[model samples]
Target chain A: MKSKGALQRAIAENAAGYFFLAPWLLGFLALTLYPMIMSLYYSLTQYDMLTEPVWIGMGNYIKMFTGDATYLKSLQVTFAYVFLAVPLKLGFALVVAGIMNQKLKLIGLYRTVYYIPTLLGGSVAIAMLWKRIFSSDGIVNAILRAVFHVNPPAWIASPKYALYTLVILTVWQFGSSMIIFLAGLKQVPDEYYEAASVDGAGKVRQFFSITVPCLTPVILFNLVMQLISAFQAFTQAFIISGGKGGPLDSTMFYTLYLYTKGFYYFEMGYASAMAWVLLAIIAVFTAVIFKTSDSWVTYGSGD
Target chain B: MSTLAKRRLYAALSHAIIIAFGVVMLYPILWLIISSLKPGTVIFSNPGLIPESVSLEHYVKGWAGVGRIHFSVFFINTFIVCAAVVAANIVSCSMAAYAFARLQFAMKALWFGVMMLSIMLPTHVTTIPRYVMFHSLGWVDSYLPLTIPKLLATDAFFVFLLVQFMRGIPKDLDESATLDGCGRVSIFFRVILPLSGPALVTTALFSFLWTWDDFFNQLLYLNTPAKYTIALGLRMFMDASGNSSWGPMLAMSVLSMTPCFLLFFSLQKYFVQGIATTGLKG
Candidate 1:
């Protein structure tokens, strides 16, 4: 009789669980699942938002692969951005995390100061602020003139250096990753370091052997997130290029290009195709990382 | 030198490095604040650590509607949207998290896995379809499109975070409460929520920040200039005529960031604890 009561109680709770999850489940089905399926259908068509979608199976994909010059260029630009920005940002984060982990007075103040940039980084305000700082007569160039006695190039306006300015902007906001790294560092056993020190391991050697190896999983997490975010970067390019992705489209990131096509050109079908293609690219990249994670990522496996 | 002195040396070096990087990180924002105090032309002419002279004129101009774009309206819209989102998220996410974390259920793992998949899908991929659905529902150009989804547990990150926090609380309390004849709803509100204070605050803070900072979705759904968020309003300050108003723009930028900065500092203790623990199980 007691077992029967317990079973009835479990059944009642299960019903309550479904009731509690109804709203989220409804949203997941309506908003996420339905839209996801619709986009997949939209990607194969030639709809311009107003007209009916004319089915052209694989045509959009074909044009994207064979005829589109900008697609390949965007791929290259995105790859370059991910490769350059991720490592530099992660490295800077690690260094700052190391420093912040030290026993120091007013450490909280330092953490707050560094974290301010990350809070402001993704906002339109910071993008506008970046525009000013990298403009022709902006502070960077003025400083260059005063210190180096040479005029610096218009950082955001020049095609050759525009992307680099963004990379620098991204690297400057290394605080979020740095905070995560600091948290991970705290989890590292102090005994390992003490043992290493006893074996005459200096700070540098200890960092390589003890710190880096242990921090690999956290590092991989930050890397994957940063890479995906960088590929979809739109605001900085949009703001700096004055919404044109201009200076000959040198700063035309994939998402920016996709936006221009979809919104500005009203090529909804094409834009949907581009979105799927970008999604596939990101998926493949993420899958590659996951595949290789086991080789380098040591989770709770200390030597 | 002894080991103690050597460790002190290392700590000093670390402090110096962190402080130096902190200054570099803060320089551009400092520049923006200083530039906001200078006159329009003088901004480019003198880019220095300190302003040539302090002025509130730019603040006045920026606060006043610039060419029909009202900053105050944007601030109100953002506040309303963000507040609604926080309220809805807290209520719905807490309920769902309690169910998943404490209750016995079938297909719980499958449902959780579905929520995890939702996080990996790039939002842009679904933008077109969401727009179409919203248009059909007549929610386009309305705050409903921006705010309604939070009523659902659509924010999987917060749901995941709350679940982890809920799991940490001892289940013996639930059993005792059950023995006392309390229902699941009462137990959730009286027992689970009060114990999950830190997690709730963290979720609220992130919801506020994300809603305030969200620009693209706002740009998509909010068509009328009168309905712009502060982020969109700030973008409207940029003149297409190649003659941008640097002073007022910078002033608005600085003003816009103040609330978020204040919110973060006020909740710093909870924020740090929440982030560290969230990463552990999330």
Candidate 2:
């Protein structure tokens, strides 16, 4: 009798579970699952949103790989961006986190102030402001001329430095990674540091021997997340370059290029193919990071 | 030198470095706030931190907006979309998370995996087909295309977050409530929702900020000027020549950042805690 009652209760609870999961189930089916599968299908066809999809197997992929100079340029630009921005941002974040880990007066206020840029960084207006600041006669060059007697080139206008301005912007908004690092830092026991000091280890030695090892998991976390985000960075380039990866395509982020191909040129199929390749690339990178993380990342529980 | 004196000197050096970085970080925003008050022609000319002669012309003109739609309309549009999303997410996500956390269902493990995978997937891949789906549903120019996803808990980030939060809470309370003959629905509404205050606030905050800052989707769907959100409206100020009402745009940009700044300041503790924990979990 008791077993029957328990079985009935389990059945009822399962029904309730389905009730609560109804919305997500519907969403996963119609929106996420459906769109993801159809995107794969869309990648293989020539559908311009107005015409019935012309089934062309692997043609888009072949064109993209074999003859697409713009694609190659975008790939180069994106790789350069990812390589430069991710490390610089992480390093800056780690440095700041080191400083912030120290107990200081008005630290909360300072943190709030520091995080202000990250919050507003992605907005169109901020990007617009960046464009203005990097203009030839704008505040940046004006300050450079006044302070150092250097006639700075129009940073955003020149192809040589346009993408680097975006890099600077990305590095400046290292607030999130800093917060994560600080959390990891706080978890390091005071006893470990005291023990290191007793053993005559210097601050740098203690940091490497104690703090660095304990924070490796967090370091790995920041690395993977920031890498993925950097790969898909779109708004900065799109807004900065005025939606057309202009002035010799210096700031054409891969996503921006994909956007132009789909929206401006109405080649949705080609864009889908591009998007699919990016997805696969990101997935592979993420998997590699996870696989390698076991060797470096140390957790508190050792799990 | 004494150890105490050495420590004092080191602390001072640290403060100096932090203070310097603080200024560098804040200078752009400060210049923006100052430039918003300066006359248009004097903006680039006056590179000083403060405006020489203050003017409210930018504020006046930016509020007037381009064409017929005022900037206030854009703010209202953003507020409506954000409010609906926040409400929908707090409700739907909590439900989904509660199910994931407290109950066993068919394919529970598989569903969990799918949700996690969705969180990992970059949104760029799904944007096209999702656009096509919405277009076919005649939601091309409407708020439905943007807001409906929130209603369905399509943002697995919040679901995952809330699930982790709920999992942290002990199951003892739910067991007692069940013993009291409280149904799962009652346990959800009467017990769990009340306990998930900080997590819900975090959800509401992120949903509001992300929706407000979202440009691409808003740009894609809402082509008409009247329907533009703050992000889309701000982009409208940028004409083809890379020049627009510079001062007004600055003023409006300052205005655009105000809501986020105010919320962050007032709720600094929750924001910091939420962000710190969210990163560690991921």
Which one wins on TM-score? 2
B-chain TM-score, candidate 2? 0.95
User: Where's the lowest-lDDT run of ten residues in candidate 1 chain B?
Assistant: B273-282
- Error of model 1, residue B138, in angstroms: 1.6
For candidate 1, give the docking quality class from DockQ: medium
Candidate 1 chain A has its poorest 10 consecutive residues by lDDT at: A94-103
lDDT of 1 by residue, A1-303 (tens): 999999998888898898888777887888888988998899999988777899999888898889988877777776777788889999988877876776688998898888888877888899988888888888888888998999789888898998898888888878778878888998898899889989999888887888888899898888787777777888877888877776767778888888888888888888899999989988998999989999999898643
Interface RMSD of each: 2.6, 2.0
Residue B12, model 2, lDDT: 87
- Residues A209-268 of candidate 2 have per-residue lDDT tens digits of 887788999999899889988998988898889887766888888999998888889898
Measured by TM-score, how close is model 1 to the native structure?
Answer: 0.96
Judged by DockQ cut-offs, the docking class of candidate 2 is medium
